[model samples]
Target: MKLTTCFSTVRTRMVSSQPKYELIQEVGRGSYGVVYEAVVKRTRARVAVKKIRCHSPENVELALREFWALSSIQSQHPNVIHLEECILQRDHLAQRMNHGSSSPLYLELVETSLKGEISFDPCCAYYLWFVTDFCDGGDMNAYLLSRKPSRKTNTSFMLQLGSALAFLHRNQIIHRDLKPDNILISQACTPAGSCEPTLKVADFGLSKVCSTSGLNPEEPASVNKCFLSTACGTDFYMAPEVWEGHYTAKADIFALGVIIWAMVERITFVDVETQKELLGSYVQQGSEIVPLGEALLENPKMELLIPARKKSMNSHMKQLIREMLSANPQERPDAFELELRLVRIACRELDWDT
Candidate 1:
């Protein structure tokens, strides 16, 4: 049986007994899955393999969302994570679940997502494997904090992120969760021996694609108009509207603002879950650091003290960030405009050499 998703038709079947990729080492692990550093046995090209066990509805939903979002995007962007392919394994049989294809096992996953819990034989376990590019540098938080602060790195990252967000928005995708940890870095070195890295926005489990249909047939539907009510995102990176249980793509702008602000000032906080210091912006209230979203929700009119840590900051950049993090989503600029502003700021105001 074949299943048609909102994006495309599913077609997949069982593959040969030969293993395509050989696992090398464990790279990372989370609640849903474990990531491995692997390589293709035939070509010996390095790739990151994510093994996700679909044991529950929540896990199935998250896996499908990531698969749908990445597979739906026909043209890949430089700063966005590239999904090479997906393989589904059940018992001793393995099937290649390529984009726009599905099998009985794949359909079973879709049913599990829509119909909640399903019965799986005790001996049979379903696992989905996602193979993608292997980021050598590491996550954004570790990469930036490992080295001394540089305006060149900051400017480059800002431009790259802006471009990425703009591309996603253009494709009508809203990344509900945007944080430093979700952003990966691919290491690179310039001819002048400067540390330059390309940013890849990963983890699309919370991403949503806005519908193209609009109230008016003549007017094109804008991602900004597609409001989402579910309050989902990292606490420190959520926008005020998101905290209130309603927001649009503009929430992404606010999250990006928090990241760029913390990155520029080198502000960090310890993550309660991992007990790791992560770079992110938050509001200080009575000695305790509070989420910026919650603080704004309590007092919408409250003014933020821009450059709270830095003694002096660029006037234009400060203003732009303030607008991006504004309490009102309407006040925040969309991703398209943000990309233009970032480019102008990098070229005119910021000194690349410094």
Candidate 2:
């Protein structure tokens, strides 16, 4: 409880109805809504607030979906965004949190997004707001742009990211969108007395929570029948099975594979539009799309064996990544397995018996 706020009161408004927190600044805006940095009056706890409007039935439903997903995940997953509370009523004309149809969400405050730019886009013409903690360290993509990452640093990132995925999968939740922009970083003290950037998985707009106990993969995929088919997510990182409309939680692991490859080589994953077109062409011609592993190997700069390039890790790590990007979803390891492998890599790098 650091009782200090970020933005000043001259820019903030203290409303009587919601006396506990003060709206500080309009920090960000996206396709869905705008984000605000607010602070609690008594405890002075700073938080991010997603300001959304419920003008139409579609908007209201989207707001409900985001609120449900955010509120549900916060209870069990520490790596996920923490939702403070959902303020279900915000009169658009009046500009205060009164009993209305629109909802605004309160969340933990973090510093930056993976893009490193918090400049408000001013495109929130829709309804509903969602909130989450501010991640100070920025997203992994922005961080990578700032500097090349060492193997150990990237491994730490992979470990944390995998751990987060493990928690979500165990809870029967599937994060359909797992890209660099959705992954955030927070500053934390490591065992070596160093402040390090730890990964926090963000953005659950396209997430899926299985109605059935989502914990077991061995169970019939039709048990809950809810989490069976998901043809959603960024195309470049999407698995083939996902493209075919039959997949499980392993789809996320495929995205993680693309992320790991990018982390190792300091490369941006392929564009979504290109991925879609290529996959679409394959669909039109009834041809099987080639795996991304071939494309990665073909990249001259991403030669996993270039010893001169101290930026990337050894080939064994590349091999692990290949396993993650398997064409068949079943061949891909689960988050738990990936975490174990990352642990082994960490231990080996530290010279501990694994």
Q: What Cα-based lDDT does every candidate model obtain?
A: 0.85, 0.58
In model 1, how large is the Cα lDDT of residue 107? Answer: 84
- The pairs that clash in candidate 1 are 10-101, 10-102, 11-101, 11-102, 12-102
lDDT of 2 by residue, 1-354 (tens): 221222222312322333445778776676566777777677776677776654444344445545556665536455777765554332321122222223222110011112233222224332343446767776777776677557667767778888888877766677888888778777767799898787778877677766643567566233113445747776656766677777778888878887776666665433355341111101111344433533433341233232213544555575677678766566677878888887787666552111
Q: Relative to the unseen true structure, what is the Cα RMSD of model 2?
A: 10.0
Cα displacement (angstroms), candidate 1, residue 154, comes to 0.4
What TM-score would you give candidate 1 relative to the actual structure?
0.91
Candidate number achieving the greatest TM-score relative to the actual structure: 1
Q: Summarize candidate 1's per-residue lDDT along 1-354 as a digit string, tens digits.
A: 111111111233556554667778898999989998888767888888898988888898899889988888889898999998887878767776765555677888888888877645536788888888889889999999899998888999999999999999998899999999999998767898875699999999999888666677666468899988989989999998998888899999999999999988889999887899999888888879998888988888988887876466888888999999899889999999999999999989875222
Of the candidates shown, which would achieve the greatest lDDT relative to the real structure? 1
Clashes of each: 5, 17
| TM-scores of all candidate predictions against the true structure | 0.91, 0.68
